[model samples]
Structure formats: C-alpha cells, structure tokens
Target: MSYKWLKFFIMWLPVIVVGLWEYVRHVFLLPFISMELGNFLAPALVFLITLTLTRGLFAKLEQMQEALQRERLSKASFQQREQLARELHDGISQSLFLLSVKLDRLEHTELNDEARETTEQIRKTVKHVYEDVRQSIANLQSPAVVVDDSWLNAIHSAASDLLQNSGVHVQLDWQLPEGVLTNKQMVELQAIIREALMNVRKYAQATEVQVICHQLDDDGNFDCEIRDNGVGAESSEIEAKDRYGIRMMKDRAEQMDWSFYITSAKGEGTRIRIMSGGDKNE
Candidate 1:
C-alpha cells in the first residue's frame, strides 16, 4: 500500500474508532455499567484498538525496510561488475587489438615457408580470442557510471571486483601521487595490471596478490608490481598455449616505454613487474 494512503487512514482511524465505541457504549452498555467502571473500561478498549492498528503499520514498515535494503545491495553488485567490464574494455580490449596486429605481422613476415601451417593455426586462435573479448565487452557493459573519476579508483574497482568474486586477496601499496602519470600511462598501466591479475586467476593458483606502485627514483624508475602466492610455472610453461595475455601486457608496457617482467619458479608463486626507467614522475 502507498504510504500516503496508509498515513491518511491512520490519521483518521483513532477518531472513527473512538466515536463508534462511544456510540455503542452509550446505547448498549450505559445501563449495566457503573460510571466508574465505564470510565475505566473506555481506556482499555482504545488501548486494544490502537495496539492492533499500530502493530500492522509497524509490520508493513519492516517489510518496506527489508525490500529497500535488498535493492541497494543488488544495485551495488551490478555497479561493481559494470565497473570491471569498463576496465576490461579500456585495458584488455585495447591490448587485444595490439596482439592481433603483432600476430598479423608474424604470420606474414616472421614465419619460414615450412611454418606456414603452424602460423595459420596460431592466427586462427588469436582471431578467436580477439572476438571473444569483444563479445564479452558488449555483453558486460551497462549504462551505469561504474567507476569514479580517479585513476586510483579505477584500480580499486578492478581489485574489488576480483576480490569479491575469487579466492584471491589483494594488498595495495599505492605510492604514486595523483596526476603524476599521464593519462596514456594510466590507461596502459591499468590494462597491464589487469592482465597480470587475470594471469594469476587463470594460472597462478594463488591465494593472495599484492599490487605495489611506487616512484623509486634511486635510479629514476617508475615501477608497479603484482605479486602472488600461488603455484608457479617454469618459463616453458609460461610460453605454452594461451600466452597471448602475457605478450599483450609486454607490448603495452613497451608502447609506454615501460619494461615488463614476469619471474616465477615452481611452487614459489609469480611476480609481474613493470618499470619506466625515466623520470619517476613522468
């Protein structure tokens, strides 16, 4: 029921109940009841009536509260996923485009005549991965403002989305002051970090991840690190099937003049680091 109607009914209920009770008492009970008894009995009837009506009103209020709470939670969850989708589009989607270009170059230029069939196979795989990412971005995006206006908040949203859904825990050490990285750098770095996290999810088999960003001018380096405590793999395993994600990250880092490194040992987890060997603030 609408609150307006319910409130109006409540406002008039006490008056109607009191009038009816008074009429009945005067016509039917006035003869048998003493004056003192009638006076005492009047309060008891009003109390009972008020209690019954207010009890229902309070119950309705509780129901409304619960529904409101549920809606807020549902909206919050959708917004979080929406934010991740945007991040994927901004970071991974662009990197995939780069990967396709590199694959095209390799298919046409780098392969020997004997390797044509194998190169064609890898080309088909790359095409499939590229299309899958595009489809995901389309299906995942919503018209909601999923991210705040800050780059760090974008990073936070990415981390939150991953942590909320997976068994991985994140520890963030943000040391770069706001506005230090150019917008291009921010986009590249965001995508790089995102790809690193996905690798951890798909292959790292880790329980914890730490993202560390700093401007260590000891040798004028801008560095970001993603570390995980998970089942690590040998370098050969890292180069095995579906290593395109890592290559995309590396290409993105190089595009921004940042050096990307992935170091791992069996049973020792993995560390992915990106460094710009120039001005730390730049």
Candidate 2:
C-alpha cells in the first residue's frame, strides 16, 4: 500500500520473473542452456542488486522521517509562540499600560516632596514595565510578513520598528553572507532578533543603539549583537525578577537552539548577543 513497499515489490519483481523463467526452461525444455555456475551466480547477483537498491531507498526514507520531525517541531513551537503572544498583548501588556496611566495620574496629585518623588519613580517604573510588556508581546508574535530567503532583512526590519516605536536611535551594521539560511532558519532567527530588540527598547533607555549581524567562521553560522548606550543594570539582582521579557528572550533562544549572552553594568550600558551555529538547518 505504501510507496516504500511498492518500490520494494517492483525491485524484486525482475529477479522473481527471471528465476521463474529459468525454472520453466530447466523443467520443460529438452536441453537447458543454463550452466550450474550461471544458475548460482544469477541469484547472488540479484540479491546484491536488491540489497543495494533497498539500502538507498531506506536512506532516503530516513531523511524524509527527519524532515517530518523537524516540521512537526517547528509547527508546535510556532503555535506556542502565537498563543503566548496573544496572552501578553491582550492580558498582561494591556494591564501594564493601564497601570502606567493610573500611576501618571497619581503622580500629579498634591503631596509632600518625598511622596511626589516616590510617586514619580513609581510612574517611571510602571512605564518601563509597560514597554517591556509590549516588547515581549512583539517578540512572541510571528513576523508581519512571511519570511523568504532574506533573514537579514527581517532582522533589520524588526530592529527598525522597535527603534522607531520607542524613539531609540539605532545604527545597523549588517554583513550577512548570501545563502547562509533557508526560509525556516530565517524565520527563527528573525524571532530571536525581534526579542533582542524588544529587550533593548524596554530596559535600555540608551540614546544610541548598535546592531551587528554577520556570518561566523564560514561555517554557515550567523550571529547578532545588539548594544545600547542607556544605563545598564545595577546588579544581578536587578535582573532576577520573575519577568516575561527576559524569560521570553531566553525561551526563544532555546527553541532556536541558539546561544544567547547578555552583558550590562550600572553605567556601562547593555549588550545582548545571539549565536546559532549547530542547528542552522532548522
């Protein structure tokens, strides 16, 4: 019923018919022109040919199986990302935006100097949180357009959108070698860059941002670096919060089988880098 079985049957049919014809000639004909050595070699040669053909077919089948497995994993990951994006946009992100607005109103109320300063701080913190939420949502959502050959273009587009929306000045330096990525790989890489840029817009109030994309080691691997000039984290404790933005970024990197690194200090600014070397064929 299956193509594999059909192919197997077809491959053996020639040997089967040849053997049957030889048997009829030996049994019914008066003089058989078949030598005993030829008779022995005929089956052996058929067996060797069948083995070779089947081995090649099996190898092709294994490749097909691997491709199917990758497709299934990709589909599952995409669905999960989509669901999380919706939840963040409609549930968490909207709530944070509303909370920021409320905090702003509270900050304007008459209060003592200390109280006003505290209120302003709260407002600023909430606004930052809101931005983080929106960025997280964007990172989880699928790209605005279907990705084709140019993953670098998708990364650039996502970075530009984040900078424009957040009013961050960005400098892009991209040098991606041609044909380094397939369509699927490009999609996943685009998602990683999107998350990285979102983190930049939310946490890095940096006046200037730099993004670098290039091939690594001629191994068909690519890496991205996003640096911001804003004040960085004061301590590791500052990033220890159970927040969605950083968590999503890490999750995306893991899903793509990529390596991600973040570096920051109190006044030194922040840098986020992602590298995908092993799983380039995804």
Candidate 3:
C-alpha cells in the first residue's frame, strides 16, 4: 500500500476500534461487562491491533524511502555526467581537433630544422591532449558505477601513468574509508593530485614522490598530501611558473571548502596538502 494511505489507516485505526468497542458494550454487552472493564480493555485491544498491523510496515516504508532516495541520486549523477560530456565534446574536443589539423599542416610545410623540431614536439603534446579528451568523452558516455576501490584505483593509475617513464619512486598511503568522500570531493581531490603529479613529472626533478590520504581522527576530517623529493623552488618562483595549475587546484578546493596549500623551499622538496575540515557534504 502507499505510505500515505497506510499512515492514514494507522492514525485512525485506534479511534475506530474504540468507537466500535463502545457501541458493542452499550448495545449488547452492557449486562456482561462493566464500564470500568470496557474502558481498560478498549485501550489494551487498540494497542494490540495497532502493534500487530504496523509492526513491520514501518521498516518496509523506511526501506522504500531509502531506495527512492538512491534512485534520485543516481539520476542526478547521470545528468551531470551527460552535461560534462556534452561540454567536452562540443568545446575542448573540437578545439583540440582543430589544433591537431593545424599542427599537421605545419608538419607538411617547409620549415627550418629547429622550427620543425619544435613543431613536432608541440604536435606530440597536442596529440596526447586530444587522446585524453577523447577518452574522457568516452568514459562520460559509458555507464559508470563507483565501486569501493574505484577512486583509490584512479589515484594510483594517474600516478603510475605520469611517473612511469620518469623513473620516480612512488609511495601511496590511503587509509580513509571508501565511502567517506562525496562525489565532488572525489573529483576535486583526484584532479588536484593529478595536477600535482604532472608538475612533479615535468619540473620537479624529483626522485621520489609520495601521496598520502587518511582520516585525521575519529571525526570525519581527512588529510591528503602530495609530496615530492625534488629541487623545490621558492614560493614566488612556484607561483610564477605553476600559476595556472596551482590556481585551478586552489579553485577546486575552494569550491568544496577544503583547505589547500603548497609548501616548498629552494632546496627542500615540494608538498601540496588538501585537508577536509570534518565537512563531507557539498
């Protein structure tokens, strides 16, 4: 039965039962039962009937409501993914395709040796970006289910991909529960880590990198860090060279209200940290 109808029945059942008991007592049982006994039995009988009728119904209704909520969340997630896919396909993907075509034309045109080499390098980078964009679109178009280890695997995979040929040693420490993070947290955290890893691969000149994420306490607060044992630069220099990537990461952190900061010195390695201040919902 629908919850509304069930609730209505439960609410009025006691009153109806009491009224019927009073009618039967006055009409037929007046000689058999006293007013005192009828009054006491009426409440007892009503309680038993209500308990019998509504025992498991409440639990069932709770389960049904929970299932409905999950379905709504799933639909919202799917819609967001669809919108993102459209944006990438219509905007970044098209732009990358045009850039690739221009690079191909430049490859065919006559050029000096140095210019040709530079063009080839730029072409390779653009090709990589285009491939990444295509892969993202494909993923967005596909059905996605976030399993327990999915986000963890994503972080590991990103690190492995970027540092595979760079000869950098990687250490990963993840201790937070799988379900502790919200979807926005997962996305923003992964993006920040990927950006930091890319910087390490391209400019850190580091031999070792460590990625760590764990709960701060029994509370829901969490801490995530990306540290590299590389030739770090001063704050000003880092801001000058890595402004775009760092700014993007900062913006993402701000969107989620997470704390994000970078610490580095000329000789010391660079460390990027993002902390959740016990707030998990977006």
- In the predicted model 2, the residue pairs found to clash are 206-230
- Candidate 1 vs candidate 3: the TM-score winner is 3
Model 3 clash tally? 0
Candidate 3's residue-wise lDDT over 200-232, tens digit each? 876789999999989887666789989999999
The candidate with the higher lDDT, 1 or 3, is 3
lDDT of 1 at 172: 93
Residue 203 lDDT in model 2? 69
lDDT of 2 by residue, 30-104 (tens): 274557755775677677667766777777788778767756766776688898888888888888778877877
**Per-residue alpha-carbon lDDT of model 1 for 71-150, expressed as tens digits?**
57547755776888889878987887887787778876766776888777877776777765764574345322222245
- Decide which is better by lDDT, 1 or 2: 1
Candidate 2, superposed: residue stretches over 4 Å from native: 1-34, 104-117, 143-156, 162-195, 199-282
Collision count of model 1: 0
lDDT of 2: 0.71
After superposition on all C-alphas, the RMSD of every candidate to the true structure, in Å, is 14.5, 7.3, 6.5
Listed in order, each prediction's TM-score against the native is 0.49, 0.57, 0.63
Off by over 4 Å in 1: 1-149, 218-221, 278-282
